[model samples]
Target: MSTMIFSRTDETPGIHGHTRDCTGAKGSSTLAKLGKGDIVVVDAPDINRTLAQKLIDAHVGGVVNTGAFTTGNVPNFGPQMLLDADITLVENVDPELPGKVKNGKKGRLNDGKVYYGDRSIGQGEVLDEETARTRFLDAREALIDHMEALSGNTAEFVSTEAPLLIDGLGIPDLDVDMDDRKVLVVSPDPQLEEKLKSLRYFIREYDPVMIGVDQAVDELIGHGYRPAVIIGDPDLISSDNLRSGAAVILPADPDGHAAGLERIQDLGVGAMTFPAATGDATDLALLLAEYHGASMVVNLGPTLDLDRVFDTAAAPGTPSAMLSRLRVGNRLVDSTAVAELYRVSRSGGGWLWAILGILAAVVVIVLIAGLSGSDGFVDNLIDSWNNIALKFQDLFS
Candidate 1:
């Protein structure tokens, strides 16, 4: 059984099992460290449980969730799974209790439990079932408040560039478009690279303009697609790609480290340098593409979730650019969707695997229903199965 020790703001005083070390790296690295003992601290219900499950599946000992077991939205499925696996589960550290006694800052919230620094806090007294229920609600409210605060800051930063974005719009030229052009967007991560490769097939079929956002230029280069435009502050992307004849967009801020602007000027590639403000330039690039005449812009490995937004914030700018693209409607295609659409091939092996999966699923359902002696379950399964079969048959026939 895995042991998960965490602290919550809702617990009573003097709990020893609710806290964990978290001072060095407060996020993923801290979580990774906890994996050594199979003991993990999960304090925020607003934290993506999908991410938590990914950690747990990697053999994390157990999760000590601070909030409710299940608040319906970001369900506690991962924690529940940890419980079902007989992992140690505890919650509700005293919210008002002093957590880490760091540098004379002795009084702090229960969230202070998961630090790698000296000093320690523990889970408070375990509640009876009814008190646990009430504390769960309190935890849920605390989580909500945290989420709202984070979201507000994100929204503020995203909105900072709205005016410039609005002013920069123009009618897009459609005639110079090349049909079915393949483009690749590069990122440092292998997962992102895989996602881009999957999305490329669809974009290739369409033959639209391929715009590489930042390091995605390398991704395109590796896959044999020439990037038409490289958009970003030059710090993350190589100045070489810009100097090597690709068009570059430089952000306006000197601190934005709009590198390669001079090279772009020397190379005479059409470049636009915008003020380096809070919003993302990737969003600017998408908007620019639309203004300049891209029929459809497909994003490869763009940030799409809250956690990603947080991660991306560690980069130079706000993710307002991606958020702006969201408001752009059908003009932007999320690369993840494209990847899913193109992941399976129409060739022999692909069709064979899909058929086998469906057949195996059908067999399992039939066997399970038969063993349960539930006519309703079997009947519903058959009815749904028949409807699917009939639709396919009709289409083919």
Candidate 2:
């Protein structure tokens, strides 16, 4: 239990999720100002109480919850624990809504009763759940639109193309022969921490490059691994990490905190700054590693699958960044591979038996389906054949 009090002036729609999950465009920006050890009191009572408890567990200080804990269906114990722990709890500041007073920023409830922060000032009203969700979705759509708009723009084309020049040189793949290439990716969010940790074994074995995007550097440093490459603009990642000896690749545009080429020069280290092409630089860093001939680039916190892409792309610049990397043949490591490798490496007889059982089951299924004369069975067989055909297309197309 940490004991301190801090205030958030901005009550952005997504701040609750951001503070809890530690991702999202505005959340990342705010989180960069606070670290693992810092404490801040929040004004929003509508925040998920579970998230509040998580923050307390992580040693966050007392919160001055403005709205009554019960107003938004958020947990009661979340605030109760703070009171139980003797953490400062302030409630019912009516003249000045608890959120506004705690945030120390003036805001107004919109016609729809949602909080809309002034982008320039970084302050907004606290929105109700329905409005917040709607705004969040809109923000996502806007980001996707931005990514699409920037994908082929000259700035993106130039930045993305400069690296591809190496491809034309016919350079042999650079052997990532360094046995010491072990990497640890970090994120402050527990869910993200679990996600990254899931791939720990694969990261350890096929270690090629250690790359951290934004606050991931803090997470990595906490785990005793200094990143070789730190991607993203200086907005979210502390200037201290950027100044540290790690190679800093800045973003191109201001939207995604795209590091400027000049900042790369100022860093006074071997650095690469890409034009803020349409995607996040984390994706760029991974592709850049692959393009530069890393034998096996094992991403610790890299985004994989369509769902993750959609989630990450909801942020302003991620959509274009992801789309651009996809064009460059950047390989998104499969989560299944992570599970398989871990099982094979960690499990013994049980894994072997499980594999044998799966193979036997597959064989039996194919034989039975082949012999079954019913139309349903035949339809299933044709669907399987089409799936195989699609896989072949993916492999060769």
Evaluated with lDDT, which candidate comes out highest?
A: 1
Give the best candidate by TM-score.
1
Tens digits of lDDT, candidate 1, 118-227: 34444533223454345446655655765576577667755765554565523223333433333333333447656756665675676556667666676666767766
In terms of TM-score, how similar is model 1 to the real structure? 0.49
Cα lDDT tens digits, model 2, 105-145, are 33323221213244321222333444444544565565576
TM-score for predicted model 2 compared with the true structure: 0.39
Error of 1 at 79 (Å): 3.1
**Model 1 Cα displacement at 177 (Å)?**
4.1
Poorly placed runs, candidate 2 (over 4 Å): 1-190, 238-240, 254-270, 302-304, 308-319, 325-330, 334-340, 348-397
Candidate 2 lowest-lDDT run of ten: 14-23
Error of 2 at 22 (Å): 23
